[model samples]
Target: MALAGKAAVVIWNDVTPEARSDFLAWHGREHVPERVSIAGFRRGRRGRAVSGGPEFFTLYEVENEAFLGGAYLRRLNDPTPWTRRVMPAFRQASRALCRVEFSLGAGVGGFVATAVLPELADADGAFRSALQRTAEALFAAQSALTGLHLLRCDANASREKTAEHGLRRETPELPAGVLLAEAGDAAPLADVVAGFSEKMASETGRRFEAGRIAIYRLELCLAAGEVLPPWDGSPTFAGEGD
Candidate 1:
């Protein structure tokens, strides 16, 4: 499957080892399902690094970029108790609310690779279009890949301040243009990702850093259809800023 819609929220972060257990519980049990239940969000996936980059990566598919500022913003501004507690555990966070530029796949896979491409030169749509075409051709030749996608950030939506932002230890960095490749397993990704970088660089007349590619293994997945109702059982639940 390509993507659920035209836009997605791509997140990268590290959770301190001291808070790892709590972070996992809060994220899988409370956070992702809550977001997917919102009107425009379609699916949420959580991945833990198998190789490089941040310790955790999150992806949320949305109907369009407009949804980022709509209900999703409200959710971020009003943090749930678990969200409040877990926010402080995050380090090196970068969330990019993006427009899905190109997507191809059979469906999502168990393993994924990501590259944080430098921001593209927006003045030349044709140049970016050529890159997209090259990506599509690369996708066609890969036997192990289950998904490939290009996402360009919507800066304004991503940088919007929220109550949740205040709970974090540091400010979140905005997403740059990103390229993600998904596969069913880890064995085939290194060579494929390297090929993508080399080929993309050749097509774009620039050096695409293959070394930046990071690998992750899917940890948790939730879709709107599977959303559980929010729980209200914790009496000691501390809301944001507590």
Candidate 2:
């Protein structure tokens, strides 16, 4: 199980309950396609919280950190009318552009348990070393864990340009580090991650605040050449050409 790509861009947000349906429609029909069509994008996956935390999550795998500033930013700057309409409806949006430091897994799964840890004052070398050690320990403990990826936020690559489109909820502060573990079932994986968190804290004397773990069920996943269901009766945007 090698890493999927050099970097991953993650977006987590809560959509107003009233806008949930349309939000999902736009994401599946327009957003995912538009992103994956970009040259460096490998895949795009979206998930919804099955347990606790934000209602929506999206992950985009890109060739490298440079892709964030290249093709990706160009799209972000030019929003479709539908994108313009849907952007403002997102609440508590948090975006992160991350460098994929380590990954261990054979394949993706139906569910993912993610742990977002706050930044520490430690130097980059020490911080990455600690995360690697913890991730290795977790992998050794659970065989069903299909993927364990550690992402370090690349602050310069993160942006909130959507604000210009009137979708201006303050971006949540980026996590210093993110851990994503995939599994067939959410419940058991959640428990495993919890225990792993405890072990990491106890051994290292570092406290990752509780309630930061979220479990999500895969909702939409797309890659190049996949046919997207027609956006029947959905709102249209002028010049929506991908």
Candidate 3:
């Protein structure tokens, strides 16, 4: 399916093991719903790593790049009490504010593969054309690949500090670019994603580090219209199921 919007914020972070449950509660009960409630936001998806990379990955689709600096940034600067409670436990957090460069899909798959692709020093129209062609070929070869998205990171936009960032323990990271592929099962993407990674690297004449690529099972999903449980401003850790 086409994305809900033109741009998205992709994040990768590891929460302290001791705070995992609280993190889950904060994310599902308070975070996702709150973010989607913003005017330009569309949908949110949270995933838990089943194979590699960080413990959690979250994607928030927004109407366009402008919203990142507008309502979104405003919300970031004024965090809720629950947000403040959970933010301090975040670690190794990397975030990217991105424009959807290329995407192909019919539906949201049960599983997704995440990887950070290096930036192209002098990318041009021809480079984008090549990227689409490569994506099409890769899509055609793997039936399990139900959805795929390529995001071009806006480093400047992503690097801005906010109240939330100030609460984190470690420094924030900016990814060069990001690739997301969704499939019904994890097996098909294991080799195909690495292959695409290599081909993409070949296009840029750069080394593709596939080590960060990971397969995650979809854990939480929220949409703009979904009804969220009321947040009473308490710091209770409620799991998604709760």
Please write out the lDDT profile of model 1 over residues 1-242, one tens digit for every residue: 88888999888889899999889878887989888988889999999999987888999999887788878888888999889988988998877789988788899899988778765445267667776777777778887889888788877867777998787754444546878889998887877767777776777786665335688999898988896645454434458456
TM-score of 3: 0.90
Task: Give the Cα error of residue 37 in candidate 3, in Å.
Answer: 0.9
TM-score, every prediction: 0.87, 0.85, 0.90
**Residue ranges of candidate 3 with Cα displaced over 4 Å:** 170-172, 202-211, 231-242
For model 2, the local distance difference test gives 0.77
Q: Encode model 3's per-residue lDDT on 1-242: one tens digit a residue.
A: 86778899998889988988888888998899999999889999998899986888899988888888878899989999988988889988888889988889988888889887755434577678778887999998888788888888898888788998798764455667778899889888778778888787787665545547878899988989896767655755669557
* Angstrom error at residue 118, model 3: 3.0
Best by TM-score: 3
Give the Cα error of residue 7 in candidate 2, in Å.
Answer: 0.5
Question: Predictions ranked by TM-score, top down?
Answer: 3, 1, 2
What is candidate 2's CA lDDT for residue 119?
Answer: 54
How many residue pairs clash in all the candidates, one count each?
2, 0, 2
How many Å off is the CA of 14 in candidate 2?
A: 1.1
lDDT of 2 at 199: 67
Q: What pairs collide in candidate 3?
A: 1-106, 1-107
